[model samples]
Target: RTVTLYAPASGIVLEKKVMQGQAITAGEELYTIADLSDVWVDAPLREADAGVVATGTSAILDFNSYPGHPFSGRVSYVYPTLGEQSRTVRARITVPNPNRLLKPGMYATVRLNTSAQSALAVPQSAVVQTGDRAIVFIDVGSGRLVPRAVTVGRSGSDYVEVLTGLKGGDRVVTSAQFLIDSESNLGEAMGAMSGMGTSPQGKK
Candidate 1:
């Protein structure tokens, strides 16, 4: 039995490879059309950063063709293979283009919004970095500042997740974290030196 492949849908011929009666075979792609509605973007991410990426992650797509306009999309599929030269994985995201404003080969910036949860978080200004650890000053009461170490997780521009060493409803000194950090360091140093007159085993 012989079958003919008709144009999928009637639209302007974006690319025509065969003429009216050119020989064609089944399952052969001969023509391409430009349907700006419902487009796909090959969002790329570094291989090292692929751990946090997963399907269904919300994303915002920005196209150079339509400046100042952002389209919403989601992580449809993540390519398993990595680019040999760039060592980057191209995660495929589908965006609805009902306005037909997006075109093929246009540059796009894909932004991923991670999971949201009710975790103990503090203002960005409340955290201070001391070498590899993060420290924050908590206002216990009566203008007392208590310095403590905290484990942090995913952070946004205004808030940082406090993974440990903090609980909900704890008031943190955000404006004076740096000053508190200096005080904590001075206190620790004094304590360490105070026992210097003792044996080394006592210091430990």
Candidate 2:
């Protein structure tokens, strides 16, 4: 009787774990096969940004090794849950490798485009985080940076989405906000305490 070994899938052999003609158990590692015809790129998108991304969306990937060469891909899957550690949603993109140039463990940059509605956005520098709440300083005429709380959504490396508490044509302080935020907090505390020192009948 003759027994033949067959690979589950057709692909190039990456590594040979077992020696030729070596005795192997029923469930044992044999070889590592890689199908380089198509590649999958898994990336993490913020929960807010994930809402705008979907399957079938177009993605452009740029590899560090290959300059000026942009590979086109499409979204294959969007993970259901936002993991606790990173608070990010996973996106799986599929790209074709006709020339078999793309290899495993290569660094890549992915830009995704979807059919989602445009969101009201602001520069990331304009927003500050105070625990769960996000704060933005608005210019209420005459160089006043009024610290106001806002609801934020999906964001990129540079910009963020404003879900609520902001509107169009609003001047926001992007630079020197940290110093202003500290002063704003101090002023608010002073105002609340000033009323306490004054008597009800206007006597200090």
Candidate 3:
């Protein structure tokens, strides 16, 4: 009996080797198949940046073909090996390509957001980042702006998660944070401290 081989997955026919009724072997070259349900962006992250990339980390993928649109995904796989020349590890983020807008060869930009899981969060403008350290200007009593060191986590478009420096009720300056940041000398003051700092009363 003649056997008919079926296409593996749904995809546009890239190239067909044999026409209908042509003799084909069991292991003969068949049509290539691909699905857009799961797509990956080979984001090369520096060795330093690899620390922030872990499993389940959220990532935003943007494609030039579809401008002004972002597809949400997660860090599904992190390569164990790093590029010899670039010294950058390949972080594979899985994106949902429902409409097949993202093709295999299409180039795209990936934004990896890695930060605090659950903690007091504030506007992104409220925190000042200095290399490895993060500082925030807390509004103390009597129109006072106090500088405190905090461990920051994933930053959203408008907000950032405070890992340790803040609590639920603390009031922080959201707008014009640069003004307070400049005046407070926060970098020098909080730079010496550990992850979290305390108030004058010694309360976190």
Predicted structure with the largest lDDT when compared to the true one: 2
Candidate no. 1 TM-score:
0.53
Sliding window of 10 residues with minimal summed lDDT for model 2:
195-204
How high is each candidate's TM-score?
A: 0.53, 0.82, 0.53
Instruction: Show where candidate 2 strays beyond 4 Å.
Output: 1-3, 176-204
For model 1, the local distance difference test gives: 0.71
Candidates' C-alpha lDDT:
0.71, 0.78, 0.73
lDDT of 3: 0.73
Which candidate's TM-score is highest? 2
lDDT (tens digit, per residue) of candidate 1 on 25-104: 76877888766667788877876457678988889987877778899998889988989999788888888887767777
Better of 1 and 2 by TM-score: 2
Writing each residue's lDDT as its tens digit, candidate 2 over 119-159 gives 78889987877568787766665534456679998777898
lDDT of 2 at 204: 12
- What C-alpha lDDT, on a 0 to 100 scale, does residue 154 get in candidate 3? 50
Error of 3 at 98 (Å): 1.4
